[model samples]
Target: MCSCILLAALKNADEMLKDIISAVDTSGDGKIQYEEFRVFVEAAERQLLQLFRSIDRDKDGRLNKEELQAAFRRAGLSVPKRRLSGFFDEIDLNHDGFITFDEWRDFLLFMPTNHNGSPLEAAFSFYSSIVTVNPEGDSLVSDETLEGLGYFLAGAVSGGVSRTATAPLDRLKVYLLVNTKTSSNVAIAAAKQGRPLVALRNAGGPIVDAIVSLWKAGGLRTFFAGKLLLGWSRVLSGTDSHAGNGLNVVKIMPESAIRFGSYEASKRFLAAYEGHNDPTQISTVSKFIAGGIGGMTAQFCVYPIDTLKFRLQCETVKGGPQGNALLLRTARKMWADGGLRAAYRGLGLGLVGMFPYSAIDIGTFELLKKSYTRAVARYYGIHEDDAQLSNVATAVLGATSGALGATIVYPLNVLRTRLQTQGTAMHPPTYTGIVDVATRTVRNEGVRGLYKGLTPNLLKVAPALSITWVCYENMKSLLKL
Candidate 1:
């Protein structure tokens, strides 16, 4: 069995090497010249630099054994102590106890051609050594477990970064969403209150007016309100009361991790069910279903946190619990009102929106990526299997998918925001349920009321998804996933 596995791995490695060589051999000379080799080396070096930087948390430019071990653990690839010691011994050329960039690069570059023994063999040996022996002496870690960790980490980091960067726009969107009145009404109210920038209402439109209002109310800080949670702060500061403020990284990280992780898992399951061993062979409909399932799962798990975020953002518009205790106060109030049910006030509507939103978002992105790669391959007369999308292409596809998905389910988003924010301290519950909310919104604010906050939402979704996919893809590449 081990021999068969080794042979299969070697065969796959050969095929992969041929594809890599074909991709790098742009001139079609059937041979790699100095310049082509130089270009490939440069690109590989850049990828290595990214990986090195990620692993080098202290940024001192050298990777200690502990750092490498930590990085492996973080990526979900656990190496046994004996295997890790062997790896370190092989890579640490100078025996100086640290692996420098040069040593690391050389070892990887020489891995495929090492005459004494290939690292691929070492990998198989390592895997074999780590597996638990069953009654028949055959127990290996499943492929599913091996494949999920890097994606989870990538999704988490991307989600945190994108959410933090677009926090202001996100906050504004929630505010506008729950506000429900027209831009004209807001402008009129602002003018009556002698608020700043009422004169520019007609010139700059609702979005600009909203920004000015938020700014005038609390200056630049209000744009990022509710971002920093008291719980996170307390944990960071080692305080007992869990009262503090800061970025919403914690809320978004797990949400994103679950999203991408589940999406990948679902795709694998669907592919296996359909008898398609290759991921690239999965149908578009399967991708859509997987994406929807992923989105729904993530949304359901994190609905309470999302509700808190929306409530906190809306607090600026409506009076509510304030300051570092805002999150705790909000949670206490929700529990006091209806226990766990209140925390998930708009969860049904959110799930409704999430299905179509995530389906379209992920489905469109995957479809576009495959199509774009094929088109580029055809245009350049290269093998389609060897074609790869550039970063710019990935970003454009991400933005397009995000905008399309958000637009389709935008009305549901508005309704969800309203449902979540209702019955708060400042604003009494105006609508009883989803039906009442939709009916009252359409009746009082007209059809356009359901589309409130679409502007800032699009503004946030485009770049946010774009950055997310870009970062995620880059991280995956660096992790060799």
Candidate 2:
């Protein structure tokens, strides 16, 4: 008889709660808005206050570090005192050494807690009230403005991180490119010995030579030489190229932005043309075409910087002018010879290489991501969107794509660098144009010379690109995109 009476009372309480919810739902969409939900939170504050008072051993209305620590301990957490101090620092928004009633209320209802409990469940419920996209939904705010922030931010962050991580390898590549002493000796040794492959293998490869050179120069620190200055210079210079020529001018940011923007825009356009609402439905070939177009656009705008940067890095490596003097001299020389055109000496070759490189890199990454997403979705019987891969998976796929693309497009990189650095004082201008550079490279050092520093190139490209893509995806996820 007592159990039947309790069940009847529970049913009545549920119906009353439903009545209150419906009454507060002004939009009549069967969902309560954030403002209405606040009313519910305010009503529950009385119950929360009792618990707060219990933790206040000194009968004070505020929570100090000690009180907060006690609360965590009561919840079965064994956080260190230092960590507890950090937590107090966070909760004490005004930093007045105490968590006030308002702050405590906010923390309990809004701040994320690692522990799972009734309070955390309530906080999550409150969080869900603000992230709606429609007026009919139960939300206080719209997330429409944040829609594209993720993708753009992801690309930018990834590009920056990748470039920074691969600075050492890139420095090595530049060093090898300008100083071909080790490679020249290797080639000579191969020629002297009838067995070219055996002789080449016997002589230390570019990696060993680079390592020895870097150590002689200044140990591991030498790899980071000019890193800080070039890094900033690349940012100041546009994305595709650099205002500072000596830093490889291949600034990753502009290329990433333009490349991602163009690819997305092109994909959208094609999808619209095909009457497909879903952008991902666009075919791989269409994506390739879009990537090609995007890559060409970005590289063309930045090619002049590309030329200047190559000259700058090469000159610096060879111990030419040190700072501003170098920049002024290079500018003056280029101007004296051909003005603006001189600054864009090897654009034709750059365009040729960039198109294929960008297209292959972007297209391959997208395809791989889709494949991974699909596989995960199949395994779990979920929608493709819901099966997004983990951060590690995304980063690995990005690195793989970058490595593959860099290998295929490496010869062009070699030729472009050689042509850009040829006219300097140490290496007299040998090539009049792209054809001349290519022909002379083959004639002078065989096909191998065209790929002088490929080992470092591959090492840098793979990780740099991987970091870029991985960072991008991670940022997007953080933004809830």
Minimum summed lDDT over a 10-residue window in model 2 is located at 1-10
In candidate 2, position 48 carries an lDDT of 58
Q: What is the Å distance of residue 63 in model 1 from its true position?
A: 29
The candidate that wins on lDDT is 1
**TM-score quality measure for candidate 2:** 0.62
Cα TM-score of candidate 1: 0.67
lDDT of each: 0.72, 0.64
What is candidate 1's CA lDDT for residue 169? 86
| lDDT of residue 148 for candidate 1 | 83
TM-score per candidate = 0.67, 0.62
Candidate 2, residue 112: the lDDT equals: 28
Give the alpha carbon lDDT tens digit for every residue of 76-188 in model 2: 44333433554566457799999787776764442222225545233333333322322343333333223444455556566666776787888788777655342356655
Q: What is the lDDT of candidate 2?
A: 0.64
